[model samples]
Target chain A: MEKKSTEQLEAICSQVRRDILRMVHACQSGHPGASLGCTEFFVALYFDQMTNNPDFNLDGPGEDLFFLSNGHISPVWYSVLARSGYFETSELKTFRKLNSRLQGHPATEEGLPGIRIASGSLGQGLSVGIGAAFAKKINKDDKTVYVLMGDGEQQEGQIWEAALSAPHHKLDNLIATIDLNGQQIDGPTKDIINLGDLKAKWEAFGWEVIVTEHGNDMSGVVKGLEKAKSLLGKGKPVLNLLHTDMGYGVDFMVGTHKWHGVAPNDEQLENALGQLKETLGDY
Target chain B: MENKLDTKYTYTEKKDTRSGFGDGLLEAGRRNENVVALCADLIGSLKMGAFQKEFPERFFQMGISEANMIGAAAGLTIGGKIPFTGTFANFSTGRVYDQIRQSVAYSEKNVKICASHAGLTLGEDGATHQILEDIGMMKMLPNMTVINPCDYNQTKAATIAIAEHEGPVYLRFGRPKWPIFTPENQEFEIGKAWKMIEGTDVTIFATGHLVWEAVEAEAILRAEGISVELINIHTIKPLDTEAILKSVAKTGCAVSAEEHQFNGGLNDSIAQTLIRNQPAPLEFIGVDDSFGESGKPEELLEKYGLNAKNIVEAAKRAISRK
Candidate 1:
């Protein structure tokens, strides 16, 4: 797989942001805040970073796997997966609707092609990622396993349980990233429960830590992912602390937790879509 | 030979069901290389040492982190690995209910959740260690198969059998040395009831350690001129409705005995089966909505109304009601 250029990936990111706003607007419910906030990271991961096949196989041998721990942000994932040919982009309209395969949370029960595990519940994906990485090692697949989680979701004790196990078992094939968007549902993560110096915390747990301040930028995400991949196979699991806003690419929704779960109304949706270029054509 | 119930069964030896799990897991590892075991710091308690010894690379020693063990076990299925997680029943279900629900059960992952030291027979470990509500918790899950095999041989056979069974399974066993009555190396069938004795007065539906207690109750009932039909309901979730209805049709009354709580274990399964299909006179022999305490296994069973005396009394009550 050839590495996608920054220009091409950025265009895809704009389309994904548009799709997120539109999908959430259509459903009249969803977490568009984190979905928009993590656009560049998702675009970078699916389009450029992972050696994944959209022609998805449940037992993905010799391929890198990704798990969305912060699964409430399904709009972004559903859009990216659809755009990447995992499914039709038209299915984006069916998201969060009754009897739709695109559930409010990503689930394998509906036989969604890109998803391997159901992950609406937070703090579980890292462990699942570690398990998949362990399986890779056992099967001699020699591929990476990546998990993306929310900053507020770090409050869950199971995250730390997984954090301790990963390095103890020497799962260097595992790469975990926390979307340090600062804002959660109630308020800023610091105001709710301070996640004081996550980099230090991860290092103390025996993980190789990588901090990317430009998590909302395509080039920065791609670079962070590449650096994380480069540091693999060195006897430590990798943790990428990705810093972004609560909502990115839109004017009003950005930098606030108010839009964490509330959908943009029709007028607000038009304003949001106006900011994002329809580079890849709207689904 | 003089009494008919005396010829029903004979015990040559007593062995812990966890040892059967250990032996069967070792055999499962040999049969299929994809089989892997993960334990949360209870290798000896779960009897996972033999499998760990034979296939050291395949076994994962997850140091007291059961949630992570469960999550990882679910992930292992994505890569075509058959993961059997080992722990005490309390930790396996109650401790990590959310983990099992989302990662394994909801996802329909092929992970075998093998739990030991179930029910009141966990003995001196007391109320905290003993789990009575695990069957209720597990059976309620949409894609979970719940099995509580009777004796050592049956537990061993169930262990091997669940490996071939696809999707998630909760195989419950105990810590005590139980009478090995079922045939050695018998092919354990899931969701199918085992008819230990064919009779007409009352049907004794039993599971886990209480299966042995039900056997003893059958003999006593036989001597009292009451014909008791004994059935070992190993699988609890997909309750063997056909066998239950058939037995009830002949017996016209029912008694359910289990080492778990009366509300959610074998009794509930039997009651639900009977009510939906054939509503018979049912009497339950189990701990009636109460927790357990530190005591000898037999003493606890006797104290909690989980022994043959309770079963015999319950059978008589059920028969009298009819």
Candidate 2:
């Protein structure tokens, strides 16, 4: 895979954001807000930060791995994975369709190239990442494991359970980032359940914490991820508190939880796509 | 179909099935370096101490969080590691059903969910600890193979055997120091039922702790001139329907026994097999839609109608109905 400049990565982010809106609008029932907001982070990881194989091996023997905890944002991941060459970009049109490799949630049952485990029921991905990291350590694979989780998903007790176990195992090879978009399906996360001081909470759990305010910015996310990589083999797992907006880029949908699950209507789809440039062309 | 009682079943000692799991897990770790063990703070109870001591790097102490253990086990499979998760039946199935369903079974990950202290025989820990409905919960999952080995020897074979077999498996065993009747070196088959005795009067399909009870009932019935054929239906999910149908065809009557709920356990499996293939008179011997309380395992078995006496009565009732 050829290395891309920050400008090229930003271009891919725009195309991914466009793909998210188009895929959601095509299905008429998929998540676009969080997918839109997490575009830059996904772009940065796949395009610039991580050394992964798009050839797609289940075991991922010598390559870095990523697990999506917040499966609702499959649009952004599918787009990024397809754009990054895991599968054909044209296959992205089959999102949530019958007999499609891209299921409503990321699943391995269909034998999807990039997916190693099924994760729709929240708070399990962190543990999975830790397990993968453990496998890497046992096999003497020096590659890292990354997990992306939703902020509202923090309400799940299993997340805390995983949060405690990762550091206890001293999985310094694992890096977890939370999409602190401050919005959930119900409303704002503050209204439903307050996750007070996640940084302090992670620190209290004995993790090396790194907070990045510009989660939607390609350069900032890339820097934060690189810093996280530098902290590995330092005897502690790292947590990146990525502060992203729920519905970013699009003017009307920005900063609202309304688009959390609801797909963009015909007019809204046009309006949303207009904001994100067609840098890599429509799938 | 003849009753192939290959050897006279006998045991001079009583051992807990959990030990078989412990020893088998240790052996499995030795056989396959990919075989790793994870325990959610039940290292002693699940008898994972030996494996932990031997393969320190392979054993993961996942604290008291069963859900995390299950999820982690699923993920371990992606890196070519076969993880065997250990915990109580209650936590292994019911507490982490979602985790097992999505992460392990649904995803088709090769995870051995080795659960100890299953059913009413979990004893004084009471109803909260004993999980009678675990079989039903796991059996309903798409890719889960539910196994309830009757004794120590069988449980040990199962623990080692599941590592060789791919996909997710739910290996159910008990805590009590029960009679060890099965052969020590028996090759544990995942979905094949074992024939303990051959008879014509009735067929007794038993699993987990109740296989020994069926054996004792065979003796009592044999004295009364009633020939009884006992079959151990170890693997409940991919049920050995052919063996069940063949045996029931010869016997004409059947008694289903288990240390689980009468509704979902071996009773349901046998009843379904019989009703679907060869419908026959079947009597159920299990906890009759009730929860177990604080008591010794023997006392609890007798009180809950899971003993030889109950089996005798049920067998007689099943035979009389024919």
Candidate 3:
């Protein structure tokens, strides 16, 4: 809907990646792989697609709402929300620490402006998105609702239950995006639990499914999101399957599942940061 | 003692707690503009047909997805709207345990998880549907308010009461057309026990459909020259500690009954309450750790030791201990 230069967006995303590393390293605990993999998507979604007025505070009266189903990737979401004016970027230091608003999982209890509910346990964001979409429709608002889920998290039966019902209820205003990284906690996705034909599975559930080759590719992300927006209000929900690299910018962390929840120690951190250019100022 | 808590209250022949929840939800929709209902495939079983038919726009038939239903309920609470999600007790708690733990309970959303067909009374469906551990599962959550009402009127009242209260709550009831003994207009209050009869020898704490059997046991005991105090422990999480301690102080012994396993039903709560506050000699009336099977409701009730005779026997034993 709104176009910001790719250079600026890319700069912002690089800062987000730094924040993700710092946030995790500071806490000495947290998920950084998926956060690094999905940083560009969050940056694109927050800076480009969503119309959330963090400055306005519509009382959630008539604002766009986003739910993070895969809440373990809180580092990227917290960074993006802060950089987008939801809060100060300095708040990134408090992530996953005691008495911090940024918890390991996203929750509304901290009175955070962007997060509507607590989510870390997976396979629940779509239903929460559907409920918020229904509320928005009931309140006569044209704003849309969005949610992000992990590809492996689709194994949760509740996600499909919500998937089948969203189209049945014709929640066309809701759009769900999946980070299809093809890896989970144990090993490769197939080794852990093969999710056969995810695109066909969603299509079978009667959703308008879209696919992107690179989740971090800004131009592709913008194009895919724009196409998803055009399909809205067509009497069906939208699903975007973004094919993302496991560690996106970091060469070593890419294409593996071992780094899913582990925080990089001092040596690994230096190696990872070496591969990723500090294009933007570090947190 | 025979005239204890006269049953002159007018109620329909008998009705499942699901119907009461449905009725209460319809009333809530009419009373509050922000009340919305979401169902996960078991709409017909949950008695949400009336709500869907009346408010097609407001009722969201969420197919067979319990995960999304929980998340959506949390999202609906973002702007001060109250969302009620309905489904079987098994799927409502066990199937989507993490969803509820994170999205709804930990987040502290004002969503009502209305679970029907709890305990062994979910007959014919057998062990898969009979979820006795749901009380313990839901109560363990930090911000969740666990309530298991006795019958149709009480369940309906609880449904209405939860919509008014602003927080996450789990309202548990059952399938069978239980004896609707409570007054029609009884105002349901959370964390308060309903004293059906006054006695000083022993106290009987009951919840859900077992409340009827407990009352019957009280009548049977009265006939056999025993004065038994009957207390309906509808809300389990907020266990009515004051009422339980006060009753146990006078009657230094207690009996707990429910249509669930002895592990995590009303008995465990009563035991914990007494252990924490006032220690009392207690007897438990429930099924042991065993799975249910396909059978008639009354036949299963008798076989599982959840009938009036079990409560009466437990009361006699409790009195002996005192």
Residue pairs in candidate 3 whose N, alpha carbon or C atoms collide under 3 angstroms: A127-B68, A127-B72, A128-B71, A128-B72, A161-B65, B41-B63
**Model 2: residues >4 Å from true position, as ranges?**
B1-8
Where does model 1 sit among the CAPRI classes? high
Model 3 lDDT on a 0 to 1 scale: 0.84
Docking class of 3: medium
Candidate 2 C-alpha lDDT tens digits along B1-322: 0123222466677899999999999999999999999999999999999999999999999999998999899889989999999999999999999999999988999999999999888889999998888888899899989999989999999999999999999999989998788888889889999998989999999999889888888887888888999999999989999999999899999999988887787789889888988789999998778888878888898888888889999999998899
In order, how many clashes per candidate?
0, 0, 6
Give RMSD to native, each candidate.
1.6, 2.6, 2.9
Question: Which candidate achieves the best lDDT against the true structure?
Answer: 1
lDDT of each: 0.92, 0.91, 0.84
What does candidate 3's lDDT look like per residue over A1-283, in tens digits? 3578988788888778878887888888998889989987898889987887877352377767788889999999998888888888888899888999998888777688787777887778888888888888888888889889998898887788788888887889999999999989887888778998989999999999999887889889888988999999999999999999877777777778867888888887887777666765665
Which residue runs does candidate 1 get wrong by more than 4 Å? B1-7
Q: What lDDT does candidate 1 reach at residue B111? A: 98
What's each prediction's TM-score?
0.99, 0.98, 0.92
**For model 2 chain A, the run of ten residues with the poorest summed lDDT:** A268-277
- How many angstroms is residue A123 displaced in model 2 relative to the true structure, after the best TM-score fit? 0.8
Estimate, for each residue in B93-188, the C-alpha lDDT of model 1 and write its tens digit.
Answer: 999999999999999999999999998998999999889999989998999999999888998999999999999999999999988888998988
Best by DockQ: 1
Q: How well is each residue in B47-83 modelled by candidate 3, as lDDT tens digits?
A: 8888888888777766666777777787787666798
